[model samples]
Target: MATFSLLVTANPHSSQGQFSAIQFAKTLISQGHILKRVFFYADGVLVASRLNCPPSDEYNLTKTWAKLAIEHDFELVACVTVAMKRGITNAAEAERNALTGDNLDPAFEISGLGQLTEAMLESDRLVTFG
Candidate 1:
């Protein structure tokens, strides 16, 4: 089975990119392929925000991605610089930066772009959804 890395570069709510990434990951897993990593960059960092509460009738892509990461043991990483710039802060960063509270979900980690590069190097395929 091919090992895949998904690079997300769009907002979850604004476009279909985030949903597409999630679906692709799920399909790959179902087909017995491995999802090695999910790298959130640019506006895609919003997927890690715990503050994202989609309406009851709407599909919550953030939660979906988080669950998938936890269930399948895929590395869920967000670019620290991009996340901070977009106001998406994890517990540690929030405390260090004296932010109001932790807005990032625990399912994802704030990391550098090197993780993305590593995923690309390690995985058999690097697919981008944006």
Candidate 2:
């Protein structure tokens, strides 16, 4: 089984790529492959936002991603630069920036490009979705 790391650069709600990435991750895991990490960058950082409230009938992308990560024991990392720029920040970042609150989900971690590089170096394959 191949070990894979994924980079997602698409917006969770506005783009289809994000959904595809999620499906791909699920499929790979079911097939006995190892998904080491999913690094969210660019518009993909939106996936880490806890404030996302999709219609009740719609797919809860953020929650689904979180659940998947927890179930599979993989890392879900959002690019710190993009996430902050997009107003998606963790408690630490919000406090540091003097923001009123943080919208980043607890299930996701804020990190830099180095994490993505490390995932690439450690995994057998690095796939990009966007």
Q: Which candidate is the best by TM-score?
A: 2
Worst window of 10 by summed lDDT in candidate 2: 10-19
Judged by lDDT against the true structure, how good is candidate 2?
0.95
Cα error, residue 3 of model 1, in Å, equals 0.6
Q: State the weakest 10-residue window (summed lDDT) of model 1.
A: 60-69
Candidate 1 Cα RMSD (Å): 0.9
Off by over 4 Å in 2: none
Residue 27 deviation, candidate 2, in Å? 0.6
| Model 2 CA lDDT for position 82 | 90
Candidate number achieving the greatest lDDT relative to the actual structure: 2
lDDT of 1 by residue, 13-99 (tens): 789998888888999999999999999999999888988998999998778888888999998899999899889998789898899
Model 1, residue 1: displacement in angstroms?
0.8
Q: lDDT of each prediction vs. the true structure?
A: 0.91, 0.95
- Angstrom error of the Cα, residue 28, model 2: value is 0.5
**TM-score, each model?**
0.96, 0.98
Candidate 2 residues 17-94, lDDT tens each? 889999999999999999999999999999898999999999998999999999999999999999899999999999
